[model samples]
Target: MLYRKKRYRINDYVFIGDNCHIGNNAFISSSVKIWNNKRIENNDKITQCNL
Candidate 1:
């Protein structure tokens, strides 16, 4: 797992798999799961799982 910046917010029940990259100002909502080898860009807002 790699984080591009320190500024980010991850809500409750968030699952981030292996080899995932979360960029700056990223916001992950509740119950959102990010699968493996995924890349979330800067200022991203994730509200659901990425399969």
Candidate 2:
């Protein structure tokens, strides 16, 4: 996904598949929870994410 100063908020849980791509200026809040066994590839410009 392409995020330019955009925020992605996960209330309950988040499950990402393999070869997932996250673009620049992405914001994942601290309340968000990421599950195990998921793959996340951040190309560049990571903004906010507790994990």
- Alpha-carbon lDDT, every model: 0.87, 0.41
Top-TM-score structure, candidate number? 1
Give me the runs in candidate 2 sitting further than 4 Å from their true place: 1-12, 28-51
Instruction: Please give the lDDT score at residue 38 for candidate 1.
Output: 94
* Tens digit per residue, CA lDDT, model 1, 1-51: 985447889998999999999888989998888999999998999887654
Candidate 1, residue 15: the lDDT equals: 91
lDDT top scorer? 1
What TM-score do all the candidates reach, one by one? 0.82, 0.27
RMSD of each: 4.2, 10.3
Candidate 2 lDDT over residue span 1-51, tens digit each = 985673443333444444555444443443443444433344332223333
**How many backbone clashes are present in model 2?**
0
